[model samples]
Target chain A: MSLTHREFWMMVHLGLGVMFLHTFFEGILWLHTGERLRRLRIGTGVMALVAWLTVVSGTWLVYPWYRAKPPAGADLADYPRAYLLANPSISQWHIFGMEWKEHVGWLSPILATAVAWTVLRYGGQLARDRRLRQVLLVLFVAAFTTAGIAGALGAFINKVAPNTFLDG
Target chain B: MAHIEIDPVTPSIIEEINSLTSSSDRPALPNGQAGAAILSAGIGSALLGFFVVLAEASTTAKQLMTLDAGVGPLSGKTTFAVAGWLIAWAVLHSRWRKQTIDFARITMIALILLGLGLLGTFPPFYMLFAQH
Candidate 1:
Protein backbone atom coordinates (compact mmCIF):
# COMPACT_ATOMS: atom_id res chain seq x y z
CA MET A 1 0.00 0.00 0.00
CA SER A 2 1.20 3.51 -0.78
CA LEU A 3 2.02 5.50 2.33
CA THR A 4 -0.11 8.59 2.96
CA HIS A 5 1.49 11.91 3.89
CA ARG A 6 0.43 11.54 7.51
CA GLU A 7 1.75 8.00 7.66
CA PHE A 8 5.03 9.02 6.06
CA TRP A 9 5.47 11.97 8.41
CA MET A 10 4.54 9.86 11.41
CA MET A 11 7.10 7.23 10.43
CA VAL A 12 9.74 9.91 10.03
CA HIS A 13 8.97 11.46 13.39
CA LEU A 14 9.05 8.05 15.01
CA GLY A 15 12.42 7.43 13.40
CA LEU A 16 13.68 10.74 14.71
CA GLY A 17 12.58 9.95 18.22
CA VAL A 18 14.08 6.48 18.07
CA MET A 19 17.41 7.76 16.74
CA PHE A 20 17.53 10.33 19.51
CA LEU A 21 16.88 7.65 22.11
CA HIS A 22 19.51 5.48 20.49
CA THR A 23 22.06 8.23 20.88
CA PHE A 24 21.09 8.66 24.47
CA PHE A 25 21.61 4.98 25.13
CA GLU A 26 24.89 4.83 23.22
CA GLY A 27 26.13 7.85 25.14
CA ILE A 28 25.33 6.10 28.39
CA LEU A 29 27.09 3.01 27.18
CA TRP A 30 30.10 5.10 26.22
CA LEU A 31 30.49 5.96 29.88
CA HIS A 32 30.90 2.31 30.78
CA THR A 33 34.23 0.44 30.88
CA GLY A 34 33.10 -2.90 29.56
CA GLU A 35 32.30 -1.72 26.04
CA ARG A 36 35.18 -0.78 23.81
CA LEU A 37 35.42 2.83 22.71
CA ARG A 38 35.58 1.72 19.07
CA ARG A 39 32.15 0.18 19.25
CA LEU A 40 30.68 3.26 20.95
CA ARG A 41 32.26 5.49 18.35
CA ILE A 42 30.58 3.56 15.59
CA GLY A 43 27.30 3.70 17.49
CA THR A 44 27.55 7.47 17.84
CA GLY A 45 28.43 7.78 14.16
CA VAL A 46 25.26 5.91 13.25
CA MET A 47 23.34 8.17 15.57
CA ALA A 48 24.75 11.19 13.77
CA LEU A 49 23.67 9.83 10.39
CA VAL A 50 20.18 9.13 11.73
CA ALA A 51 20.05 12.56 13.35
CA TRP A 52 20.88 14.42 10.12
CA LEU A 53 18.24 12.39 8.33
CA THR A 54 15.80 13.32 11.08
CA VAL A 55 16.73 16.97 10.69
CA VAL A 56 15.97 16.88 7.00
CA SER A 57 12.74 14.95 7.54
CA GLY A 58 11.70 17.29 10.34
CA THR A 59 12.19 20.27 8.07
CA TRP A 60 9.91 18.60 5.55
CA LEU A 61 7.41 18.10 8.38
CA VAL A 62 7.64 21.68 9.61
CA TYR A 63 7.35 23.65 6.39
CA PRO A 64 3.79 22.59 5.58
CA TRP A 65 2.76 22.86 9.19
CA TYR A 66 4.02 26.43 9.45
CA ARG A 67 2.38 27.45 6.18
CA ALA A 68 -1.01 26.03 7.13
CA LYS A 69 -3.90 28.46 7.39
CA PRO A 70 -7.60 28.25 8.10
CA PRO A 71 -10.14 28.31 5.25
CA ALA A 72 -10.21 31.81 3.71
CA GLY A 73 -11.75 34.62 5.81
CA ALA A 74 -11.73 32.48 8.94
CA ASP A 75 -10.19 35.14 11.21
CA LEU A 76 -11.01 34.47 14.86
CA ALA A 77 -11.51 30.79 14.06
CA ASP A 78 -7.71 30.47 13.90
CA TYR A 79 -7.91 29.67 17.60
CA PRO A 80 -4.49 30.28 19.19
CA ARG A 81 -3.39 32.96 16.76
CA ALA A 82 -6.45 35.08 17.39
CA TYR A 83 -6.68 34.17 21.05
CA LEU A 84 -2.97 34.76 21.52
CA LEU A 85 -3.21 38.27 20.06
CA ALA A 86 -5.65 39.31 22.79
CA ASN A 87 -3.43 37.85 25.52
CA PRO A 88 0.12 39.16 25.06
CA SER A 89 1.60 37.39 28.10
CA ILE A 90 0.31 33.97 27.14
CA SER A 91 1.18 34.70 23.54
CA GLN A 92 4.72 35.61 24.46
CA TRP A 93 5.15 32.46 26.52
CA HIS A 94 3.65 30.27 23.84
CA ILE A 95 5.69 31.88 21.10
CA PHE A 96 8.81 31.60 23.20
CA GLY A 97 8.27 27.91 23.84
CA MET A 98 7.47 27.25 20.18
CA GLU A 99 10.48 29.15 18.98
CA TRP A 100 12.70 27.49 21.53
CA LYS A 101 11.58 24.08 20.35
CA GLU A 102 12.09 24.88 16.69
CA HIS A 103 15.46 26.48 17.24
CA VAL A 104 16.78 23.74 19.52
CA GLY A 105 15.48 21.10 17.16
CA TRP A 106 17.80 22.45 14.50
CA LEU A 107 20.77 21.53 16.66
CA SER A 108 20.16 17.80 16.46
CA PRO A 109 22.46 17.43 13.51
CA ILE A 110 25.11 19.58 15.09
CA LEU A 111 24.92 17.75 18.38
CA ALA A 112 24.98 14.35 16.80
CA THR A 113 27.81 15.30 14.49
CA ALA A 114 29.82 16.63 17.38
CA VAL A 115 29.29 13.53 19.46
CA ALA A 116 30.24 11.29 16.58
CA TRP A 117 33.29 13.30 15.59
CA THR A 118 34.53 13.67 19.12
CA VAL A 119 34.27 9.97 19.72
CA LEU A 120 35.99 9.20 16.47
CA ARG A 121 38.85 11.58 17.17
CA TYR A 122 39.20 11.11 20.90
CA GLY A 123 37.62 7.87 21.84
CA GLY A 124 40.86 6.47 23.15
CA GLN A 125 41.54 9.48 25.34
CA LEU A 126 37.93 9.81 26.35
CA ALA A 127 37.79 6.18 27.39
CA ARG A 128 40.79 6.64 29.62
CA ASP A 129 40.21 10.13 31.01
CA ARG A 130 37.63 10.70 33.71
CA ARG A 131 37.43 14.43 33.07
CA LEU A 132 36.82 13.96 29.35
CA ARG A 133 34.17 11.36 30.02
CA GLN A 134 32.35 13.80 32.27
CA VAL A 135 32.34 16.41 29.52
CA LEU A 136 31.04 13.91 26.98
CA LEU A 137 28.33 12.91 29.41
CA VAL A 138 27.22 16.52 29.76
CA LEU A 139 27.14 17.00 25.98
CA PHE A 140 25.09 13.87 25.56
CA VAL A 141 22.66 14.98 28.24
CA ALA A 142 22.30 18.37 26.62
CA ALA A 143 21.58 16.86 23.22
CA PHE A 144 18.99 14.48 24.67
CA THR A 145 17.37 17.27 26.69
CA THR A 146 17.04 19.51 23.63
CA ALA A 147 15.38 16.71 21.64
CA GLY A 148 12.96 16.04 24.50
CA ILE A 149 12.02 19.70 24.80
CA ALA A 150 11.55 20.06 21.06
CA GLY A 151 9.35 16.95 20.93
CA ALA A 152 7.22 18.33 23.76
CA LEU A 153 6.76 21.60 21.89
CA GLY A 154 5.76 19.74 18.72
CA ALA A 155 3.08 17.87 20.72
CA PHE A 156 1.83 21.19 22.06
CA ILE A 157 1.65 22.61 18.55
CA ASN A 158 -0.30 19.58 17.30
CA LYS A 159 -2.86 20.04 20.08
CA VAL A 160 -3.32 23.75 19.40
CA ALA A 161 -3.12 23.77 15.62
CA PRO A 162 -6.21 23.98 13.41
CA ASN A 163 -5.48 20.63 11.85
CA THR A 164 -3.15 17.82 12.75
CA PHE A 165 -2.18 14.54 11.14
CA LEU A 166 -4.12 12.82 13.90
CA ASP A 167 -7.40 14.49 12.89
CA GLY A 168 -7.79 12.54 9.66
CA MET B 1 64.33 -23.30 25.62
CA ALA B 2 61.02 -24.50 27.07
CA HIS B 3 58.44 -24.70 24.21
CA ILE B 4 56.00 -22.07 25.43
CA GLU B 5 53.66 -20.64 22.81
CA ILE B 6 50.72 -18.32 23.36
CA ASP B 7 47.64 -18.09 21.20
CA PRO B 8 47.83 -14.84 19.24
CA VAL B 9 44.11 -14.60 18.43
CA THR B 10 42.00 -12.93 21.19
CA PRO B 11 44.36 -12.34 24.08
CA SER B 12 47.18 -10.77 22.06
CA ILE B 13 44.90 -8.20 20.41
CA ILE B 14 43.31 -7.32 23.74
CA GLU B 15 46.73 -7.04 25.38
CA GLU B 16 47.95 -4.73 22.61
CA ILE B 17 44.95 -2.46 23.08
CA ASN B 18 45.55 -2.44 26.82
CA SER B 19 49.14 -1.46 26.30
CA LEU B 20 48.08 1.39 24.03
CA THR B 21 45.57 2.71 26.54
CA SER B 22 48.24 2.68 29.27
CA SER B 23 50.66 4.71 27.19
CA SER B 24 50.98 8.31 28.50
CA ASP B 25 52.34 9.89 25.33
CA ARG B 26 49.02 10.16 23.55
CA PRO B 27 48.20 13.44 21.82
CA ALA B 28 45.74 15.82 23.45
CA LEU B 29 42.27 15.24 22.13
CA PRO B 30 39.32 17.65 22.23
CA ASN B 31 37.64 15.51 24.88
CA GLY B 32 34.23 16.50 23.44
CA GLN B 33 34.54 20.06 24.74
CA ALA B 34 35.18 22.02 21.54
CA GLY B 35 32.75 19.83 19.67
CA ALA B 36 30.17 20.52 22.39
CA ALA B 37 30.76 24.26 22.05
CA ILE B 38 30.36 24.08 18.31
CA LEU B 39 27.14 22.13 18.71
CA SER B 40 25.85 24.60 21.29
CA ALA B 41 26.75 27.42 18.94
CA GLY B 42 24.34 25.96 16.42
CA ILE B 43 21.62 25.98 19.07
CA GLY B 44 22.50 29.49 20.26
CA SER B 45 22.57 30.97 16.79
CA ALA B 46 19.32 29.28 15.82
CA LEU B 47 17.70 30.69 18.97
CA LEU B 48 19.15 34.10 18.28
CA GLY B 49 17.83 33.92 14.74
CA PHE B 50 14.37 32.90 15.95
CA PHE B 51 14.13 35.84 18.33
CA VAL B 52 15.59 38.23 15.82
CA VAL B 53 13.09 37.11 13.21
CA LEU B 54 10.21 37.30 15.65
CA ALA B 55 11.26 40.79 16.65
CA GLU B 56 11.15 41.88 13.04
CA ALA B 57 8.38 39.60 11.75
CA SER B 58 5.86 42.39 11.71
CA THR B 59 7.92 44.42 9.25
CA THR B 60 9.78 41.63 7.51
CA ALA B 61 6.60 39.71 6.75
CA LYS B 62 5.52 42.47 4.44
CA GLN B 63 8.67 42.42 2.32
CA LEU B 64 8.88 38.62 2.36
CA MET B 65 7.19 37.07 -0.66
CA THR B 66 4.72 34.44 0.36
CA LEU B 67 4.34 32.07 -2.55
CA ASP B 68 2.15 29.05 -3.26
CA ALA B 69 5.27 27.34 -2.13
CA GLY B 70 6.04 28.04 1.55
CA VAL B 71 8.76 30.60 0.96
CA GLY B 72 8.91 33.00 3.89
CA PRO B 73 11.25 35.00 6.09
CA LEU B 74 11.23 32.28 8.71
CA SER B 75 13.02 29.93 6.34
CA GLY B 76 15.43 32.69 5.38
CA LYS B 77 16.12 33.47 9.01
CA THR B 78 16.77 29.80 9.73
CA THR B 79 19.16 29.57 6.81
CA PHE B 80 20.92 32.71 7.94
CA ALA B 81 21.19 31.29 11.46
CA VAL B 82 22.58 27.98 10.31
CA ALA B 83 25.06 29.75 8.06
CA GLY B 84 26.22 31.93 10.91
CA TRP B 85 26.69 28.85 13.09
CA LEU B 86 28.71 27.06 10.42
CA ILE B 87 30.96 30.09 10.12
CA ALA B 88 31.42 30.27 13.86
CA TRP B 89 32.18 26.56 14.01
CA ALA B 90 34.72 26.94 11.25
CA VAL B 91 36.51 29.68 13.13
CA LEU B 92 36.48 27.70 16.36
CA HIS B 93 37.66 24.61 14.59
CA SER B 94 40.54 26.51 13.05
CA ARG B 95 41.59 27.87 16.41
CA TRP B 96 41.21 24.47 17.95
CA ARG B 97 43.53 23.06 15.36
CA LYS B 98 46.21 25.70 15.98
CA GLN B 99 46.09 26.11 19.73
CA THR B 100 47.54 23.95 22.46
CA ILE B 101 45.30 25.50 25.13
CA ASP B 102 43.37 23.38 27.57
CA PHE B 103 40.60 21.97 25.37
CA ALA B 104 37.82 21.85 27.91
CA ARG B 105 38.54 25.31 29.38
CA ILE B 106 38.71 26.98 25.99
CA THR B 107 35.51 25.27 24.97
CA MET B 108 33.81 26.60 28.11
CA ILE B 109 35.00 30.04 27.19
CA ALA B 110 33.65 29.64 23.66
CA LEU B 111 30.30 28.49 25.02
CA ILE B 112 30.10 31.52 27.32
CA LEU B 113 30.86 33.85 24.44
CA LEU B 114 28.20 32.25 22.28
CA GLY B 115 25.68 32.45 25.14
CA LEU B 116 26.45 36.11 25.59
CA GLY B 117 26.10 36.58 21.86
CA LEU B 118 22.64 35.03 22.12
CA LEU B 119 21.61 37.40 24.95
CA GLY B 120 22.73 40.35 22.89
CA THR B 121 20.21 39.48 20.17
CA PHE B 122 17.21 39.69 22.48
CA PRO B 123 14.43 42.04 21.35
CA PRO B 124 14.53 44.10 24.53
CA PHE B 125 18.25 44.62 24.25
CA TYR B 126 19.18 45.05 20.60
CA MET B 127 15.86 45.66 18.88
CA LEU B 128 14.25 47.91 21.45
CA PHE B 129 17.36 49.99 21.99
CA ALA B 130 17.91 50.37 18.26
CA GLN B 131 14.35 51.47 17.57
CA HIS B 132 14.63 54.11 20.26
Candidate 2:
Protein backbone atom coordinates (compact mmCIF):
# COMPACT_ATOMS: atom_id res chain seq x y z
CA MET A 1 0.00 0.00 0.00
CA SER A 2 1.17 3.52 -0.72
CA LEU A 3 2.13 5.45 2.39
CA THR A 4 0.65 8.82 3.24
CA HIS A 5 2.84 11.93 3.53
CA ARG A 6 2.37 12.08 7.29
CA GLU A 7 3.34 8.45 7.68
CA PHE A 8 6.41 8.91 5.51
CA TRP A 9 7.59 12.05 7.29
CA MET A 10 6.96 10.46 10.66
CA MET A 11 9.06 7.49 9.67
CA VAL A 12 11.93 9.70 8.60
CA HIS A 13 11.67 11.74 11.77
CA LEU A 14 11.72 8.58 13.84
CA GLY A 15 14.65 7.26 11.85
CA LEU A 16 16.63 10.42 12.44
CA GLY A 17 15.87 10.24 16.15
CA VAL A 18 17.27 6.73 16.28
CA MET A 19 20.35 7.89 14.47
CA PHE A 20 20.82 10.76 16.91
CA LEU A 21 20.60 8.53 19.97
CA HIS A 22 23.11 6.13 18.50
CA THR A 23 25.66 8.82 17.73
CA PHE A 24 24.92 10.75 20.94
CA PHE A 25 25.63 7.80 23.21
CA GLU A 26 28.78 6.97 21.30
CA GLY A 27 29.94 10.55 21.66
CA ILE A 28 29.38 10.38 25.40
CA LEU A 29 31.41 7.22 25.63
CA TRP A 30 34.18 8.82 23.63
CA LEU A 31 34.20 11.78 25.98
CA HIS A 32 34.22 9.54 29.04
CA THR A 33 37.46 7.88 28.05
CA GLY A 34 40.46 9.72 29.42
CA GLU A 35 42.85 8.84 26.67
CA ARG A 36 42.64 11.45 23.95
CA LEU A 37 42.93 9.77 20.56
CA ARG A 38 42.73 12.84 18.37
CA ARG A 39 41.25 11.08 15.37
CA LEU A 40 38.73 9.11 17.37
CA ARG A 41 37.64 12.15 19.32
CA ILE A 42 37.26 14.19 16.15
CA GLY A 43 35.23 11.43 14.54
CA THR A 44 32.94 11.17 17.53
CA GLY A 45 32.45 14.92 17.62
CA VAL A 46 31.56 15.10 13.93
CA MET A 47 29.15 12.23 14.21
CA ALA A 48 27.50 13.80 17.22
CA LEU A 49 27.10 17.07 15.35
CA VAL A 50 25.52 15.39 12.36
CA ALA A 51 23.16 13.39 14.50
CA TRP A 52 22.16 16.48 16.47
CA LEU A 53 21.42 18.43 13.31
CA THR A 54 19.40 15.63 11.81
CA VAL A 55 17.18 15.39 14.84
CA VAL A 56 16.69 19.14 15.15
CA SER A 57 15.74 19.52 11.52
CA GLY A 58 13.47 16.52 11.66
CA THR A 59 11.72 17.91 14.70
CA TRP A 60 11.35 21.30 13.12
CA LEU A 61 9.75 19.74 10.06
CA VAL A 62 7.24 17.72 12.06
CA TYR A 63 6.36 20.41 14.59
CA PRO A 64 4.16 22.49 12.34
CA TRP A 65 2.32 19.42 11.10
CA TYR A 66 1.80 18.28 14.67
CA ARG A 67 0.50 21.69 15.66
CA ALA A 68 -1.56 22.19 12.51
CA LYS A 69 -5.12 23.45 12.89
CA PRO A 70 -7.85 23.57 10.24
CA PRO A 71 -7.44 26.70 8.20
CA ALA A 72 -10.75 28.58 7.56
CA GLY A 73 -10.87 27.37 3.97
CA ALA A 74 -9.64 23.84 4.75
CA ASP A 75 -11.77 20.62 4.97
CA LEU A 76 -11.53 16.87 5.74
CA ALA A 77 -8.72 16.66 3.21
CA ASP A 78 -6.62 18.66 5.64
CA TYR A 79 -7.39 16.40 8.59
CA PRO A 80 -3.75 15.37 8.91
CA ARG A 81 -2.66 18.94 9.40
CA ALA A 82 -5.70 19.79 11.50
CA TYR A 83 -5.20 16.75 13.73
CA LEU A 84 -1.61 17.75 14.39
CA LEU A 85 -2.49 21.34 15.34
CA ALA A 86 -5.63 20.68 17.37
CA ASN A 87 -4.12 17.98 19.51
CA PRO A 88 -0.88 18.74 21.30
CA SER A 89 -0.78 15.21 22.73
CA ILE A 90 -0.36 13.68 19.26
CA SER A 91 2.84 15.61 18.86
CA GLN A 92 4.00 14.37 22.23
CA TRP A 93 3.39 10.77 21.15
CA HIS A 94 5.30 11.36 17.99
CA ILE A 95 8.13 12.79 20.05
CA PHE A 96 8.07 9.85 22.45
CA GLY A 97 7.99 7.29 19.67
CA MET A 98 10.91 8.99 18.05
CA GLU A 99 12.83 8.85 21.33
CA TRP A 100 12.11 5.17 21.82
CA LYS A 101 13.19 4.35 18.29
CA GLU A 102 16.48 6.15 18.82
CA HIS A 103 17.38 4.73 22.22
CA VAL A 104 15.94 1.21 22.01
CA GLY A 105 16.05 0.28 18.36
CA TRP A 106 19.29 -0.95 16.77
CA LEU A 107 21.52 1.42 18.72
CA SER A 108 22.75 -1.33 21.05
CA PRO A 109 24.13 -3.55 18.32
CA ILE A 110 25.76 -0.78 16.30
CA LEU A 111 27.48 0.64 19.36
CA ALA A 112 28.63 -2.83 20.31
CA THR A 113 30.36 -3.33 16.99
CA ALA A 114 32.17 -0.02 17.09
CA VAL A 115 33.33 -0.66 20.65
CA ALA A 116 34.61 -4.08 19.65
CA TRP A 117 36.65 -2.60 16.85
CA THR A 118 38.15 -0.01 19.14
CA VAL A 119 38.95 -2.62 21.76
CA LEU A 120 40.55 -5.03 19.34
CA ARG A 121 42.72 -2.27 17.91
CA TYR A 122 43.63 -0.91 21.33
CA GLY A 123 42.80 -3.90 23.45
CA GLY A 124 46.30 -4.52 24.70
CA GLN A 125 46.63 -1.04 26.15
CA LEU A 126 43.08 -1.03 27.42
CA ALA A 127 43.60 -4.35 29.14
CA ARG A 128 46.75 -3.08 30.80
CA ASP A 129 45.11 0.10 32.01
CA ARG A 130 43.41 0.64 35.36
CA ARG A 131 40.03 -0.95 36.01
CA LEU A 132 38.16 2.33 35.65
CA ARG A 133 39.80 3.04 32.33
CA GLN A 134 39.14 -0.47 31.10
CA VAL A 135 35.50 -0.27 32.06
CA LEU A 136 35.03 3.05 30.30
CA LEU A 137 36.76 1.71 27.23
CA VAL A 138 34.49 -1.30 27.13
CA LEU A 139 31.43 0.90 27.49
CA PHE A 140 32.68 3.18 24.75
CA VAL A 141 33.27 0.28 22.40
CA ALA A 142 29.86 -1.19 23.09
CA ALA A 143 28.04 2.09 22.56
CA PHE A 144 29.87 2.77 19.31
CA THR A 145 29.05 -0.67 17.87
CA THR A 146 25.38 -0.44 18.74
CA ALA A 147 25.07 3.02 17.20
CA GLY A 148 26.64 1.83 13.97
CA ILE A 149 24.22 -1.08 13.52
CA ALA A 150 21.22 1.09 14.36
CA GLY A 151 22.39 3.71 11.92
CA ALA A 152 22.63 1.17 9.10
CA LEU A 153 19.20 -0.21 9.83
CA GLY A 154 17.78 3.30 9.96
CA ALA A 155 19.22 4.08 6.54
CA PHE A 156 17.69 0.95 5.07
CA ILE A 157 14.29 1.84 6.46
CA ASN A 158 14.56 5.35 5.02
CA LYS A 159 15.32 3.96 1.58
CA VAL A 160 12.36 1.61 1.67
CA ALA A 161 9.97 4.06 3.37
CA PRO A 162 10.68 7.50 2.04
CA ASN A 163 8.86 10.34 3.83
CA THR A 164 6.15 12.03 1.75
CA PHE A 165 4.80 14.82 3.95
CA LEU A 166 5.09 17.48 1.31
CA ASP A 167 2.93 15.53 -1.12
CA GLY A 168 -0.06 15.98 1.15
CA MET B 1 96.99 34.11 54.72
CA ALA B 2 95.39 37.04 52.84
CA HIS B 3 95.29 35.08 49.54
CA ILE B 4 93.89 32.00 51.33
CA GLU B 5 91.14 34.16 52.94
CA ILE B 6 89.08 33.98 49.72
CA ASP B 7 86.01 31.97 50.77
CA PRO B 8 85.79 28.58 49.04
CA VAL B 9 82.53 27.91 47.31
CA THR B 10 80.85 24.83 48.74
CA PRO B 11 80.36 21.91 46.34
CA SER B 12 76.85 21.32 47.67
CA ILE B 13 75.84 24.96 46.95
CA ILE B 14 77.32 24.79 43.43
CA GLU B 15 75.56 21.49 42.77
CA GLU B 16 72.24 22.94 43.97
CA ILE B 17 72.64 25.94 41.65
CA ASN B 18 73.48 23.68 38.71
CA SER B 19 70.41 21.52 39.38
CA LEU B 20 68.14 24.56 39.58
CA THR B 21 69.57 25.94 36.33
CA SER B 22 69.03 22.63 34.53
CA SER B 23 65.46 22.31 35.76
CA SER B 24 64.64 25.83 34.50
CA ASP B 25 66.02 25.22 30.99
CA ARG B 26 63.50 22.60 29.75
CA PRO B 27 61.85 23.23 26.34
CA ALA B 28 58.05 23.28 25.96
CA LEU B 29 56.41 20.78 23.61
CA PRO B 30 53.85 22.08 21.14
CA ASN B 31 51.91 18.84 21.10
CA GLY B 32 51.71 18.96 24.86
CA GLN B 33 50.11 22.41 24.55
CA ALA B 34 46.92 21.03 23.05
CA GLY B 35 44.72 22.77 25.62
CA ALA B 36 44.76 26.25 24.17
CA ALA B 37 44.28 25.07 20.63
CA ILE B 38 41.36 22.82 21.52
CA LEU B 39 39.67 25.48 23.60
CA SER B 40 40.01 28.02 20.82
CA ALA B 41 38.57 25.69 18.23
CA GLY B 42 35.64 24.78 20.46
CA ILE B 43 34.77 28.39 21.29
CA GLY B 44 35.18 29.45 17.69
CA SER B 45 32.84 26.75 16.39
CA ALA B 46 30.16 27.56 18.96
CA LEU B 47 30.31 31.26 18.13
CA LEU B 48 30.00 30.58 14.44
CA GLY B 49 26.99 28.34 14.98
CA PHE B 50 25.31 30.98 17.14
CA PHE B 51 25.83 33.76 14.60
CA VAL B 52 24.64 31.67 11.67
CA VAL B 53 21.42 30.77 13.43
CA LEU B 54 20.80 34.37 14.34
CA ALA B 55 21.37 35.46 10.77
CA GLU B 56 19.10 32.77 9.38
CA ALA B 57 16.23 33.57 11.70
CA SER B 58 16.40 37.31 11.13
CA THR B 59 17.65 37.63 7.57
CA THR B 60 15.42 38.48 4.57
CA ALA B 61 17.38 35.99 2.49
CA LYS B 62 16.06 33.20 4.65
CA GLN B 63 12.51 34.48 4.29
CA LEU B 64 12.65 34.44 0.47
CA MET B 65 13.56 30.74 0.36
CA THR B 66 10.99 27.96 0.19
CA LEU B 67 10.17 27.04 3.79
CA ASP B 68 9.53 23.33 3.22
CA ALA B 69 12.71 22.61 1.31
CA GLY B 70 15.24 24.20 3.63
CA VAL B 71 15.52 24.10 7.43
CA GLY B 72 16.19 27.81 7.59
CA PRO B 73 18.68 29.01 10.21
CA LEU B 74 17.12 27.86 13.47
CA SER B 75 17.75 24.17 13.10
CA GLY B 76 21.16 24.73 11.59
CA LYS B 77 22.01 27.05 14.44
CA THR B 78 20.82 24.55 17.04
CA THR B 79 22.94 21.84 15.44
CA PHE B 80 25.95 24.11 15.54
CA ALA B 81 25.27 25.02 19.13
CA VAL B 82 25.14 21.38 20.10
CA ALA B 83 28.32 20.72 18.15
CA GLY B 84 29.98 23.68 19.79
CA TRP B 85 29.11 22.31 23.18
CA LEU B 86 30.49 18.89 22.31
CA ILE B 87 33.71 20.35 20.96
CA ALA B 88 34.05 22.70 23.88
CA TRP B 89 33.67 19.85 26.33
CA ALA B 90 36.19 17.71 24.50
CA VAL B 91 38.72 20.52 24.45
CA LEU B 92 38.17 21.46 28.06
CA HIS B 93 38.26 17.92 29.36
CA SER B 94 40.90 16.54 27.02
CA ARG B 95 43.25 19.47 26.97
CA TRP B 96 42.53 22.26 29.43
CA ARG B 97 41.14 20.43 32.43
CA LYS B 98 39.69 17.24 33.81
CA GLN B 99 36.14 16.23 32.92
CA THR B 100 33.99 16.89 35.91
CA ILE B 101 31.29 14.31 36.55
CA ASP B 102 28.51 16.85 36.29
CA PHE B 103 29.81 18.41 33.11
CA ALA B 104 30.37 15.11 31.37
CA ARG B 105 27.03 13.72 32.42
CA ILE B 106 25.16 16.84 31.35
CA THR B 107 26.70 16.88 27.91
CA MET B 108 26.02 13.20 27.38
CA ILE B 109 22.43 13.56 28.51
CA ALA B 110 21.95 16.51 26.21
CA LEU B 111 23.28 14.51 23.30
CA ILE B 112 20.95 11.69 24.12
CA LEU B 113 17.99 14.06 24.32
CA LEU B 114 18.89 15.51 20.97
CA GLY B 115 19.07 11.99 19.56
CA LEU B 116 15.63 11.25 20.89
CA GLY B 117 14.38 14.35 19.18
CA LEU B 118 15.84 13.05 15.93
CA LEU B 119 14.01 9.75 16.29
CA GLY B 120 10.71 11.62 16.31
CA THR B 121 11.13 12.01 12.55
CA PHE B 122 10.75 8.36 11.62
CA PRO B 123 8.06 6.45 9.75
CA PRO B 124 4.43 7.34 10.46
CA PHE B 125 5.83 10.73 11.45
CA TYR B 126 7.86 11.12 8.29
CA MET B 127 4.76 12.48 6.61
CA LEU B 128 5.22 15.67 8.54
CA PHE B 129 7.76 16.86 6.01
CA ALA B 130 6.30 15.39 2.80
CA GLN B 131 5.05 18.10 0.44
CA HIS B 132 1.35 18.18 -0.24
Which prediction has the highest TM-score against the true structure? 1
lDDT of 2 at B49: 32
Off by more than 4 A, model 1: A32-35, A71-97, A160-168, B1-71, B113-132
Go through the candidates in order and give each one's C-alpha lDDT.
0.57, 0.41
Angstrom error at residue B121, model 1? 10
Give the poorly placed runs of model 2, Cα more than 4 Å off.
A1-57, A60-70, A75-124, A130-167, B1-77, B93-132
lDDT of 2 by residue, A20-53 (tens): 5555554455445533344344555455444444
Model 2 residue B16 distance off true place after TM-score fit, in angstroms: 52
**Candidate 1 local lDDT, A1-168, one digit each (tens):** 677675577678767767676557756776555246656777778777776666556655644444444465755334444444446655653455555554556555565666677666665666567765665565566567667776777667656554333223
- What interface RMSD does each of the candidate structures achieve? 4.7, 14.2
- The stretch of ten residues in a row with the least summed lDDT in candidate 1 chain A is A76-85
Task: Report the lDDT of model 2 for residue A168.
Answer: 72
Cα distance off (Å), candidate 2, residue A50? 8.5
